[model samples]
Target chain A: MARADVLPLPQRRAIWRVMARRYAHLPLLAPAVAVSVAVFWACMAVLVVMSVYPFLAAGTPRFTLDAWQRFLVDPFYWGVVGTTLRIGVVVTALSLLIGYPTAYAMSKIRRPGWALACYVVLFAPILVSVVVRTYGWLLLLSQTGAVNYVLRTLGLIGQPIPLIFNTTGIIIAMVHILLPFAVFPILSVVGQLTSDLKEAAMDLGANRWQTFRRVTLPLTLPGVVAAAQIVFTLTISAFVTPFLMGGGKVQILSGLIYRDMEAVNLAFASTVALILLALAMAILAASNVLVRRSYSRAEVLRT
Target chain B: MTLVGADRVEDDVELREVSKRFGPVLAVDRVSLQVRRGEFFSLLGPSGCGKTTTLRIIGGLEYPTAGEVVLRGQVVTDVPPYRRATNMVFQHLALFPHLAVFENIAFGLRLRGLPSDVIARKVDDVLQLVDLPGFGTREIHQLSGGQKQRVAIARALVNEPAVLLLDEPLGALDLKLRLQMQAELKALQHRVGTTFLYVTHDQGEALTMSDRIAVMNQGRIEQVGTSQEIYARPQTRFVAAFIGEANFLEGRIAASAPDGVLVSVDGLQVRVAGDGSLPVGAPVTVSIRPEHVKLGAAAAGAANRWDGRVQDMTFMGAVVRATVALASGIAVVAEIQNDAAVGLAPGDAVVAGWAPQHTVVLAR
Candidate 1:
């Protein structure tokens, strides 16, 4: 066989050209890349540039630490940061608590038609607009809505309980929005688990609950962690659900940034944006470390 | 029904008219079986023959749509798998991947709320019994195939179950390892004295390991007997074809004598013993094992003899198999020892014969 290294220059150049031509679909990705750069990266760059500029600038690009310093030292901004994190943590926990069993049931459904129906139900909210879904929750949680009316008729309480215009409403709405995220990854993992393993667990004298705790739970932990990461990060940066459901009662970081931007205080808005970005990054990094450690632990058992 | 070990009539497990249905398919159809105490009984069949389903029913992992499961004289038809005094060694050796060898074996003990020290001692004892000493800390993925198999068996045996159900546990191993595990499992059953209800499609494994085997076909058992009885006197065509190599000759009963029956196949008369109850002129099939057929010089003084042409000769390591074409156009295979059948060739004319007792007559 003729070695490629020893081939004539012209022949080698021809082969290289042929290999390069094999990737003819490279230009097909141009539109997606262009949109990503033009919209997301450019906006982020502008935000970063405006964040360092001095506050109350009169058409002059003078740079200072005034915006960053004020935001960092403000106790109100700290409360906003804490609220954002609390909402993220609470929503993530609720989603997981509810989603795990739903996904497990979906995975165990043997009939294709029933499983397809479940898939449609899971992704139906995603197909609808987020604003529409939040409005649906708004109607459900309102004082005179069906829930309160039913509770009143049943004489469960004397007065209408506060559900909307508070953290409770935001949490309920966010969990509904993020449940599909939590379910899908866990569902895929659960679907991959063989029936034989479960049967073996039972045959080895482990009851149903013990089998789920020891075998099924541990095996699907990676998926659960992935779902948590997605839900947590998304809830941290969420705007529309909190804005609509909170009804100005819940002061979150994203709402503060939006308020600062609406007032045309670009410097302060950019500063709040940067703080949000940093917090999201920090939380994601911490979770990444936790996920990696857990993965390695699972890997040890596997190997 | 002459039980192989009739001295002890107490049964370890019994299935009475059990039937299981999946959708429209009857997986196990009204099957009844009895496993005596301390006996190694095998449900032997081809794939999809419902042997594994029957074993799973005994393990309580599968519920029979109709009938009862009796364990140690108690009707346990509705008992779940965890509540039963039975554990299974799965076909794939489904050892818990997350737990170490020790924890996997001690899972049942821990569920019973046994003390740590007692659990440890029991796990250690089972590990040693399975010849896996000092392997308690090793994870499942770190073990070899045979080691994993031992762990699976050990995991079940540690519970000290009254009946150990094995669902083709050695089916995943390679040929050499499968043979080795077969002998080890048989020895382990002997030492533990637990009734073993084993299920396998491999005839060789069933024959070598089982004290008695129930030959299953479709969804029902054809016959249940000792390996020798199953091999020598199969009552059904499926059993005769499934258990080993047999050359079947279709015939009718020519005469019934005090000692045996005379079967007329084509134009030839074949004498068969042990089937004298088969009425004369009844249609029957005579099954004869390949090794039982005497060829050429060995056919001298035989009760039934025939002239045949050797069509093909195959040299297996231990035995030489010859495909012989008889005068009536019926073909039969005969296996002879390699040393004695060295000179036989494809075109050679030979006289093939089998003793009257070697022939098994089955009604069509």
Candidate 2:
């Protein structure tokens, strides 16, 4: 855009280099983009094709609506969808209720060393394998496990409660495994909030609870929305924890997909996987709107 | 602490022997002051001088480690900020970023469970008072800096507080805007008629805006008085140095003159107008303003006259400053109106002197 004829050779070269640096991220991102296209999008296309046209039991591949009809017309399959969404909503809500306070307290830690210790305690479980953490949960939540034993010793229950192989076990494990995702996003947003906003609210005659409700909660809603998006989608699509904890009792969408895949029903498995993807995408899109609204409202520009 | 002055109904806010300690540092050290009802008072000091800490103590945001705080003839030392009948316009203006301007101003009223119509009416009234009547629907981030400042002020003033605490609310503005806001705030205070306890490090701002100022230094009140009193008759050396530019001449009392005291500075005797309380030979520092120093023929009737040579001259817009070296080899600056003199350059001989009343003698 500059007058190139008036510039010297080295200056022109420098300008060209600056222009080249503007798009430097394209080459840097090429490898990841290529890998995702080949392994994710390409596989997704193959799965879409397999769901509608399949060679099953030595029959030639043909386009048919059998898998779609079987999935859509069946009430049992619809129940699996219901269970998946119900667990997702319930787990997301409980995680928020528990994670919000934890994140707020963590953000309020004044000392670097203590805050670091809290971060380590909160996130160290994520480094361990999900299967291992779920197994640990099973050990803790079994009928004769430490949880029931503690309840028995406290005289709260006369008999060991049925704590595993049900919806309750799946939910408990899912909340535990997905907690860091919830707390991480919320903490990131809450920590960015300045204390002066709350003080301003109080100085304007709002009491402590009023200050939290009117100022603190609204300003930190973006983080809460992001946390919900993550935890909700993760809870819905999660397989290992629910599978191991539910012990074939809870029939979630992921479990259905795994069952069809194990029975060599490629068409049905592909259909279930696409549905799970669509559910996650829909929730993400909805929360993305929420996040945008919250972000715009809470946009603090320093002058 | 005894709340003996609760019967003094004229005082809007009082800090009696109040102190604040942050960890090991004493941020406010036994500071005691009172804000008269319906007066614009300011605590002026440098950063880290604890002026803000004292303001916060009065607002009930920070409790004093000792002593008591009285507000409108009531001992409110234990009252929290929300329970106290006071509001603060914070330094950064701390407008609620999530709320529209209307909601931001309506926050306190809404918390009190006022009806929606009443709240809306009150918010509109305050917005009109701050000169932003129709800006209720605008978000905070969309407003300019000056608009936000008005919103912050309106938010506090809408509560009709007994005393308004302001912590350098204009510190974020540019110089031109700061001056404009300073005049606007002074006018607003007059119109509202609320007792304001303002804190700032700017002496000029305090002098131009406050009815009285408490000059602070090193976490202590150096002096508190009217602007003219504090400027012309500072009770401490720190106040003398901090308020304005002054030439300090360290000396000892040579003798007590008939109406003042004569101090010997570098073998020259300078007469300073005062009570003559200090005994002879007591060490002191004599401060004289450059503008008060007369030059040329104007020095003929001055009480302390000296013959000096101009060493340097700086031409300011309206005033010219001439650094004059006296016969005793001491340099004193004399500021002259550029229009009042002619042809006085560097290295020229001149008579520099000031009246005895113009010299302030501080005990060393």
User: For every model shown, what is its TM-score relative to the native structure?
Assistant: 0.90, 0.94
* Chain B vs. true chain B: TM-score per candidate: 0.96, 0.97
For model 1, chain A alone compared with the true chain A gives a TM-score of: 0.86
Q: A1-303, model 1: which lDDT tens digit per residue?
A: 369879999999999899889987889989999999999889888888888874435667777878888888989888888899999999999999999999999988999999999999889889999999999999998998888899999999889998899999999999999999999988977877777778878877778998898788887788888899899989989999999999998999889889988988788888888878888788879887877754554555433
Residue-pair clashes per prediction, in order, are 0, 0
The TM-score obtained by model 1 is: 0.90
The most accurate candidate by lDDT is 2
User: What are the Cα lDDT values of the candidates?
Assistant: 0.89, 0.91
Q: What does candidate 2's lDDT look like per residue over A184-258, in tens digits?
A: 999988998888888888888888888988889888887898899989999999999989999998899999889
**What is candidate 1's CA lDDT for residue A86?**
97
Rate residue A175 of model 1 by lDDT: 99
Clashing pairs in 1: none
Residue B42 deviation, candidate 1, in Å? 1.1
Superposed model 2: Cα runs more than 4 Å off: A1-24, A56-59, A290-295, A299-303, B1-7
Taking the tens digit of each residue's C-alpha lDDT, what string does model 2 give over B1-364? 3455444778888889998999999999999988999999999999999999999888888888998998887899998988889999999988988889999999889887899999999999999999998999999888989999999999999889999999999999999999999999999999989998899999999999999999998789999999999999988889998999898999999998989999999999999886998999999999998999999899999989999999998989899988999997999988999975588988889998999999999999
